[model samples]
Target: MLAFLVAGVILGVLARVLHHEPDDPSPVLTVVLGAVAAAAAGGVMNLFLGDDLTALTPWSFTSSCIVTFVLLGLLEGVWWRRP
Candidate 1:
């Protein structure tokens, strides 16, 4: 929903700041991708650990951040790794 989308953008931007990426993903695309990434994360968590999300709140956003970082981090490591 709108809340998820908005929070996704904020989370994405924060992740970008944390990683110091130079405009890797546009803000809007980052948000949209983040939303999908979040859903994938939640599904993976539930399927593997039986964790279920029954509510969306501050905790949801925090979870989104964690999920986004993990997903993006892997992508970054694979494609953007520095030696």
Candidate 2:
């Protein structure tokens, strides 16, 4: 959980930095949302993949990251579409 939260925050910060748009969401908000999304994704992955929740395996980490990135991208797209 701790590792996932850290990873989420890092990814969120990286995403925010890379975008650097005036209309983008706040950094804190992005990090919080990213952490939540990552935790949710980790839970789902553990449920479906039969992996231990507390174990930080490579596969689990990779899947969580992939899910987080995809989710963030979708969120950005939705925000972009809003008028």
Candidate 3:
């Protein structure tokens, strides 16, 4: 849990820093959001993986961040941006 929180904070900060004209949420909010995301990711895995792998692990944390970032980017239409 603590590891997940720490990882989430780090991920959120990096997301903010890399935002290119980024309007990031407040640091505290970012952490909270990341935590929520991490939990959701774990829940998804639990729902899907099913009796095979343990739900929340280092891989889960990493996957949670990747999924969060990708989803955020997708919603922002990164690929459709004008360069």
Candidate with maximal lDDT? 2
**Of the pair 1 and 3, which is ahead by TM-score?**
3
Clashes of each: 0, 0, 0
The residue-by-residue lDDT of candidate 3 on 1-83, one tens digit each, is: 55555666676666656664554445565556666666566556655656233346656666777766664455334543556
Candidate order by TM-score, decreasing, is: 2, 3, 1
Model 1 pairs whose backbones collide: none
Candidate 2: the clashing residue pairs are none
Model 1 regions lying over 4 Å from their true place: 21-29, 39-63
Candidate 1 per-residue lDDT over residues 1-83, each given as its tens digit: 34555555676666666666663655565556667777555555544554454344555546656887776666544545555
For model 3, the superposed segments whose C-alpha errors exceed 4 Å read 20-23, 51-55, 71-83
Per-residue lDDT tens digits for candidate 2, residues 1-83, read: 77777788887887777776777777887788778777777767776788777567676677778878877776665765458
Candidate 2 steric clashes? 0
What would you estimate as the lDDT of candidate 2?
0.75
